[model samples]
Target: MQVPDVMTAIEISTPGGPDVLVPGKRPVPQPGPGELLVKVAAAGVNRPDVLQRRGAYPPPPGASDLPGLEVAGEVVAAGQGATHLIGTNVCALVAGGGYAEYAIAPAGTSLPVPEGLSMAEAAALPETLFTVWINLFERGFATEGEWALIHGGTSGIGTMAISLCKLFGVKAVVTCGGDDKCAAALKLGAAAAINYKTRDFVNEVRQLTGGAGVNVVLDMVGGDYIARNLAVLADDGRHVSIATQRGVTAEVSFLDIMRRRLTLTGSTLRPRTLAFKTLVAEELRATVWPFVESGQLRPVMDRTFPLREASAAHARMEGGDHVGKIVLTV
Candidate 1:
């Protein structure tokens, strides 16, 4: 592959709305030790990208200033000890710069783009997969035959949760904003989908679980939902917070948590240590890659836009009308 000196990337020209995402030229980054330089075919648009655009989430120290978290492409170059990956198709979880024509990815975090998956679908996997796996399964401890309540049923994270739950035999009950989104979630393998705009998700989940309540809750909408989430958790249930879309802080009853033996926890993936992310990549390769290769696991795509139309992509995401993952194709 002929590597370029300069590449087009979507940059946050200023901290504001989606219109702030502007296409700009940047020097193509070089791969450091244990890194691969990928010719980016597609990059997944995520909530963090939008936050970064609005100045709410900034790139970690030494990371690229561009806004993309996952990308799928071919490895065009590699640093020492990772030369074997050159010329291979892969989708990788990146710290930043995925919105560019070229992006550097950690060699350990890149996974093979299997024959059955398209570049866009592969691009959509890493962020949501790593997030749901870490929070819902590893931290929440959702297991076979257990019931889980997930907010944002039709969003990227919600759909991935539903798919993983179905594959692992966990029953997923999700909350969506509209009837159409709820229907979409049900069709995507959720045990039940609640239209939160019209119905009380707490009562719906309780009723759906036959009054025993859910064994776990994967929450993106915090604030009042935190207390309501606790209301619907079964004894010894786990509540894992992945985002605070509604608000950050909430009042919770310590007595209620103690009485039910409930657990509350959360994490952000971007600032984590490289070694920890590498370990997660290895675990996903061992456990989840099989399903992906077999064509059983795939991202539910909402739409795609040209790389230069990244502002439009951000607008679509913030509008909250997209049902699944959105991608920017190079």
Candidate 2:
């Protein structure tokens, strides 16, 4: 198929707010060697996209300046070395450029859309699922019957983490802002949902775990939550940070970490090497995709907007009222 000359995309001319996300036409990108040019059907709205739009998170070297990070689309054209994925329906975790009608993806990062999921739903899967899978399971060493705590339980990453915990039979405690969010977390298989506004999360987690504390913590809220997260960690627990919406710097006790023998680590997917991302994508296909295909796991969608309305999607995410992933249909 012949690729088009121009494509519709949401662009950020200046960084400030969601209003900066303006839809415009841009030259369509071509696939390089080992890449596939995808006709994007839908794209996910992620916190990283919001950060990029605000000029807080810039794309890495040789990546698109566009804000989007995940896309579900059909392979329209494949570059050299990517012939096997031509004409496939796929959802991929991208470094950037998903807010456009066509985006180029590394062939290895693309995965077949799981059975019974819509394109929009698939678009929502890659970023959150990949983040949760890598952090909670791979990095944190979360295992069956282990106790885990996830902060921001109503967010996209939180919801995905909770479901994975349940599927693997790991006990999970989640922290959210309200009773409704808490209830939603529990419905998604969280063993307990603590409303951070009304209760002390560290205290609640301690009580729920019979005073032994949790074995792992998936924390997106940094700063003030850091001290508390450490306080609630079980001996040899792993604390993985994925975001720092509250602030990155925190003054905490190293003695506490030393006493508990805790493991503290964090990762951002966009800056990772293509080889590393390919490995993560392959791991997801082998260990997690089957569960999605079999209905053992599902994408929790909060809302969707048209491709031109990317600003509205970001606004909704900033509002912090959403319970799951938000999407933008291209």
Candidate 3:
């Protein structure tokens, strides 16, 4: 296939709201060493994209200025180590540039789209899967038979975490905003779904665990929740955070951490070196791809929009009404 010289893309015209996103023309990015030039079919919208558009998070050095993190497409061209992937359809975790007709992705971070999945569904897999695997599983060492308390259980990553925990025999308890979201989480195999809008999660978690507390707490809401998260952990439990949606700063008692033998950690994907991403990609491909291929793991896609309507997609995402991922078709 002949690749395009230029492509249509959504650009941040100004750092502000969803309306700030506008269509523009740009040269189609070519594959660099260890990269693939993908003819993007669909792209997943994530909360970080919203943060980037609001100027809260900037693209890392050398990453595309565009604000998309994951894309599923056919590899039309390859560079260096990526040559083997030419002509294959795959989903990738990209640093940026996914919201375009053509996008570049590092070969290591790309994986074949699971059989029987559409581009939009595959597009939804990479970001949330990578986030959950790295933060909730690897860093937290989420283990079988233990309980994990997941925040935002109806969100993309939350849904994946719940399913994965169930698949691997780790029980999951989750917090969502409403009854419907709570029901959705429970349907997805969460052991318990707490509607934080109606109940105090700390008390509910304690009640659900019979006072033993959860073995791991996957947190996205930081600040005030950090203290409470630590409070609800079992002895030697892990507290892994992937985002700080509530706020960043928190006052925690060191004595509590030491006495409980708790671990607190977090990570952001884009700024990491390609080598770090490569390690994560290898692990996911080996450990998680089987579950994906067997249909036990799948994207919980909520909605989609045409590429030109990127702003509207963002509006829907920020509205927080959707239960799962929103994708952009290119």
Candidate 4:
């Protein structure tokens, strides 16, 4: 097949706001060994992408300077070691380069899209779902019947966490900003939704758990939430931090941690070795993909914009009013 000479992309020339994301043309990237050249149909816009646009989190090392982290599309070409994935409709968790007409994806990180999902929905899954699964289940050891607290309850990660918890019979309590967001979380199988603006989530979580606190807490909000998170943990509870939207620095009580026997941990999807991501992909394919295929687990998309309108997509994500994932249609 003849590949196009150039492809349209959303480029951030300098760090700032959505205005920084300007549409531009770039040569189509070729797949290297163990890679697949994907014709991107849709790409998810994540908070990290926004941070990257602001120059706070640049792509690590050899990863694309382009913003997108997850994409869904058809495989148009494959490198020498990626022959088996050619022509597959795949959704991949990419290191970068997804905010374009075409991007190269590592073969091992690409998975066949669930039978009935659209490219947009598939694009929305990889980053948030991968983050939630790795932190909550892989690191936190969340199991059936255990209570889990997910901060940012109405977010893409939070919604996916709630759905997976529901599918596995685990109880989930989520924290969001408003009543509507709380209601949305509840509808998505959060056993209880706490409006962080109106209520103290730490106290509400304790009360909801009958003063026992939760077995695990997935926190994206850092800073002040840190001290309170430690206070709300059950004995032996796992607290995992994936992002620090508020701030990273905080003063917390070490005594509380010691007394509760808590385990505090966190991870970023990027920067990990390819072997680790391949393992995560394999685990998701074996354990989580089945539920997605069965429609028991679904991507909750709040909005979408055309690839040319990437600025608007970023703005919507920053607005914080969205209930779930945001996507850029290509």
Best by TM-score: 1
lDDT of 2 by residue, 63-146 (tens): 999988999999999889997898889999899999999999898888898668899999999999889998999999999999
Which runs in model 3 stand beyond 4 Å of their true positions?
Answer: none
In order, what lDDT does every prediction score? 0.95, 0.92, 0.92, 0.92
Pick the lDDT winner.
Answer: 1
Candidate 1, residues 1-330, lDDT tens digits: the string is: 789899999989999998888899999999988999999999999999999999999999989989999999999999998999999999999999999999999998899999979999999999999999999999999999999999999999999999999999999999999999999999999999998889998888888888999999999989989999999999999999999998999999999999999999999999998899999999999999999999999999999999999999999999999999999999
- RMSD of candidate 4 to the truth, in angstroms, is 0.9
Q: What is the TM-score of each candidate against the true structure?
A: 0.99, 0.98, 0.98, 0.98
* Candidate 2 structure lDDT: 0.92
lDDT of model 4, residue 40: 98
Model 3 Cα displacement at 152 (Å)? 0.6
| Colliding pairs, model 4 | none
In angstroms, the error of model 2 at 115 is 3.0
Candidate 4, after superposition: displacement of residue 308 in Å? Answer: 0.7
